[model samples]
Target: MTSTLDDALKRLEMAVGLLEASVSRRLEAENRRGDLETELQLMQDDRARLAVELDSALTRLHRFEAATDDVSRRVRQAIGAVQSVLVQAGQLEPEEG
Candidate 1:
């Protein structure tokens, strides 16, 4: 009877130890998962912010391009007018091309 009681007590102690170890592992895994989730959220937020900045930069670039085109057109028109005036004044020859 004494030997049987001792064996049962040993088995119970081992079972409890195993249960505690399992709980500890589960808690550690949960903590690691939480940390990973937080990191993912931060990455997503950064991606969103960068996307907005990129869009803003692209919009600015397009506006600058449009302004540059308008300026070029105006310059060409001014040059044509000057050439016409010079030709009328007999100061410049018109090109045949």
Candidate 2:
């Protein structure tokens, strides 16, 4: 009877140790999951910010391209007018090449 009681007590102690170790492992996993979630949120925020900045830069580039095209058209018109005037004054000959 005494030997049986000692065996029971030892089994109980082993069970308690196993339970504690399991709980410790679960807590560590939870902490790691929380850290991963925080990092994911920060990455998402950075991606959103970068997307907005890229869109703004593209908008500015488009505006610059439009302005350059307009300037080029106006310059072409001015050059044509000058060439016509020079031809009328007999100061420039029409190119044969």
For all candidates in order, the CA lDDT equals 0.99, 0.97
RMSD of each: 1.7, 2.2
Q: In terms of TM-score, how similar is model 1 to the real structure?
A: 0.84
List the candidates' TM-scores in order.
0.84, 0.81
Clash totals for all candidate models:
0, 0
Residue 90 local lDDT, model 2? 98
The alpha-carbon deviation from the true structure for residue 91 of candidate 2, after best TM-score superposition, in angstroms, is 2.8
Model 2: per-residue lDDT, tens digit, 32-58?
999999999999999999999999999
lDDT of 1 by residue, 1-97 (tens): 9999999999999999999999999999999999999999999999999999999999999999999999999999999999999999999999688
Error of 1 at 53 (Å): 1.1
Q: Which stretches of candidate 2 lie over 4 Å from their true place?
A: 95-97
58 Cα displacement, candidate 1 (Å) = 1.6
